[model samples]
Target: MSTFEGHVYLDHHYPPVLWNIVRGGFDSVGLLPDGEKDFAISVSLASMLQNSSASRLEAELSLEQVRLATTPNSVSRLRGVFVFDDIESISRIWDSNKWGGHFIDEYLADVGVWAKKSTRVDAAWIDDIINNQGKLLPGWEAAAVKYWSGRPKSKDAPIWEVLVEGRFCIWSMHSKEAALKEISAIWPNSLGLLTHSMNCFGLGSLDGQCFAGITGNEAGISIDHYLRMIDSKEAEFIEQLARLPAESPKFFAGKPDLEKMCLPDLTGYSGRICAKDDTNLTALLNLLSQLKNETGS
Candidate 1:
C-alpha cells in the first residue's frame, strides 16, 4: 500500500508551479484559466488542493463512514476544490483514495477525524488547538474557546483543522463539477443532484427539487421527516415530492400514461457501456424519457 493516505493524484500533467503557490500560502487557482471550472462552490462540500503538479489531484475528505465522491469522475478541467495539502493533519482520519468533495467534509465535521463529536476528544488535541491558536480561524474564536473551556463547543470541528492546515477552510471539487457540466451541457434545465453516499445520477423534480441528496446517517430523503446529519443546506432542498402527493395526487402519486410517454422513433444510439461507467445508459434513458414528454416530437 502507498504511504500517502489522503492524497489523490490525477493523470493530467502541468508545471509544478501550481503546488508551489498554494503550498503553505495562497488558496486561489491562479495558474488554471478562470472558467466555470474555477468557481461555483457550495459551503456544503469539503475542499481540495494540489500537493504537486507533475500530475494532478483532487481529494475526497471524510471523517465519517458516509462516502462522498467515492469514485470521482474522470478529469480535465475541475472546480470548487480547496487548496491545502498538509497531509499529516488528516492522515489519521482520511479514508478511500477514491477522491473528492463536501459530503466527505460534512461527515468529518459532524463525526470527526478521530470519532464523532465529544466521544473522541483527546485532552491533548484540545490542548493543541488551544496552544496553536495562531493556526485557528479567529472567526471561530468561540468554537476554539469552547473546546478549551469546559463549555459546549460547536458540533463542527473539521473547519478548525482545515483552517489551521490551509489558513482557509473551503472545498474544491473538479470531478463533480465536470459531471454537472456534462449533464447540464445536454439538459440545461435539469437540476443536478449529488448524494452523500450510494451516489448516482439521481432524479430530481422539474422545478430543481431533488429526489435524493445527502441526509446524514442515510442517503434517501423524504419530505415528511428526514435526518439532517449530512448537509447544512438541507432546508433549501426539502423534497416537495412527498408533500405534493397529498395535495395534488394526480401529478405526484398517479402513474404516467405510457401511451402519452412513448418515445418518438429516432436514429439509433451510438454509444457503448463501459465496464466501469454506465452513466451513458442512464443518460440515454433520460434522453428517451425526455423525448416522450415532448409535446410534439
Candidate 2:
C-alpha cells in the first residue's frame, strides 16, 4: 500500500493554482478539455510555483524571486491546484524500459488526489400566485389543485415545501410568515417532507416563503400521518369516482397509481400490501369503502 498527502483551499475572487516541486518530482495530473479520459497530466516546474500556498494573494510578495525565476509570467491568475506522484518512482522506472505495462497501476496504488473548492450564488423563482399568497389571484384554489395534479397555467402555485427535519436549520430570505405557518402545520410530526427543500434553487423571491424545522423524534409518525391524510383525501376522490358513471370518471385518469400502491408496514420489515394480492385493483376500492363508512357516504 502507498500513501499521498495534500490540502485544498477556496475563495471567491481569483483563479486556482498549484505548486511545490522537489527535483525529480512526481507527475501531476488534472482534468482535460473535452477529452475522453477523465484526467490529464502536466509536468512543469512553473506549475508548482503557481499552485503553492506560499504564493497566495498578497503573500506572493515574499516569493516574487522564486516566481520570477521559475515561470517568467505573473502567478496571480491560477486558482485551482493538484499535485501527485508515485512513491516508488514507477514512472521513472517505466521510462527506462524496465516495465511492460503502464505505471498508472502503481500510481493508483499510491496517490489519492482531490479537487479544490469554488463558490457561486444560489436563488429560486416563484410564480405570481404563490408570490401574492394563496389569495392573490382569484380561483387560485382550483388552479392549485390543477397545479398539484401537474396541469398548471397562468396562476401561481406552491411548487415545494420546506420542512425542518431532525436538527436541520434553514435560513429563509423572505415569506417567514407563510413558512412558519406551514411549519406549525407539519413539525413535531412529519419532517422528511422537508428534505425536498434542502438544496432548492429557483424558488422566486417574495410571495414565496422559506423556513427551517428541527426533525423531531416522532418524525416517522408525522410522516405516516401526513401520507395517510393524503391517502384519505385520495380515498375521498375515489369514493366520488365510485359514485360517478364509468364514462364520467375519465377525469381521474393518469393520476396516482393507486392500484399498485403499497403503504409502509409500521410494524414489520416488509411493506404492507395496500390492496389484495393477485388482484391489485381492489386497494383503492377497499380504501374508498372504509372512508365512505366513516364519512357516512
Candidate 3:
C-alpha cells in the first residue's frame, strides 16, 4: 500500500488519556501488545491545549501525574505525547525547517490553536524518558519545545521529520483493502475492525444526522443502510433533509461565503452543510464550491 508521511501533533492532555485508552483498548481486545505499539501512535498535546483550562503549571503537573501513574506499567507500552504551545516557537526549535514547521503551523492555524511560548523542558524530559527506556516509539522523537531562547538548532527537530524518515511506516497503508490485509496478516483471528473518516465534520440538524452515520461506521458498525432508513422517516424530517443542503447553497458553490452561512457544529460527523435562515444565498453557493473542491464530492 502507498504511504503518506506527515507530522502529527497532539495536545498535552491527549497522550495520558490516549495512552490509557490504547493500552486499555488492546488489553481488552486481547492483542499481543508490545513496546513497538507505542511507536505506532503519535499524540499532539498542543491540540489538547485549545480547550484546556489548565494553566501551563497545571499542565506540567498533569504530565508528571500521568508519568507517575504509568511508570509502574510496562514502559514499552507507553506512547509519546508531543506538546507545543505555538508555531513560531516550534519553528525556532526545529532550526527553521520550513516543511515541518509550516506543516505544524498551518495545522494549528486551521484548528485555531497556536502555542504562545517555547515549551523546551517538556521536550527534553520526554526525550530523556524515551532514551532511558528502549525507544518506546520507534521513529517518534520526544516532544520538544516549539520555542526556547538559545535552543540548539538540532537539540529537537520537528516530529514530522521522524514520520518522513519512515519511523511509522508499519502503520501506513494507502487503501482500505491494504489496511485490512495488513491487519489480518498481523492478527489472523481478528474478527472486528474500526475505521474513521476524518473528512466528516460540523453540526446542525441534518449535519448531526449525517454524523450519526459517520461515527457509527467509525465505531465498527454498519451505518449506510441505517442512514437510508432515516430517509424514510416522517415527511418533515425528509423535507428538512432535502432543504438542509439548499439551506447552505454556498457550500456547493465555487466560493464559500462563511459570513452568510451559519457554521456547522463540527462536533459530530454528519458532514451536512448548515446555514442561517437570513444567510445570503450567493455566499452559500460560494461555500458550496469550496467544499466541493475540498472534498472532491
Please name the candidate that would achieve the greatest TM-score relative to the true structure. Answer: 3
Q: Estimate each model's TM-score.
A: 0.19, 0.14, 0.25
Better of 1 and 2 by TM-score: 1
For model 1, residues 176-268, the per-residue Cα lDDT tens digits are 343344433432332212121111101122121111111111332111111112232355434443354565543342332333322211112
Give the per-residue lDDT digits (tens) of candidate 2, residues 34-103: 2211112122212222233322212222122232334322211121132223222333333444322222
Poorly placed runs, candidate 1 (over 4 Å):
1-42, 45-85, 95-160, 164-177, 182-297
Rank ordering of all candidates by TM-score, starting from the highest: 3, 1, 2
| Tens-digit lDDT string for candidate 3 (1-297) | 123322333221222212212111111101112321211221222222222232432333333334334332211111222333345445654563432322343232111112111122223333423333223233332232221121333544532221111112111122223334443344333212111101011112211111111111223311110111222245875464345446754222122232323322223222222223313222323332332232111
How far in Å is the alpha carbon of 209 misplaced in model 2?
21
lDDT of each: 0.23, 0.23, 0.25
Q: Model 3 off-target regions past 4 Å?
A: 1-85, 96-109, 113-121, 132-200, 204-241, 250-297
Q: What is the lDDT of candidate 2?
A: 0.23
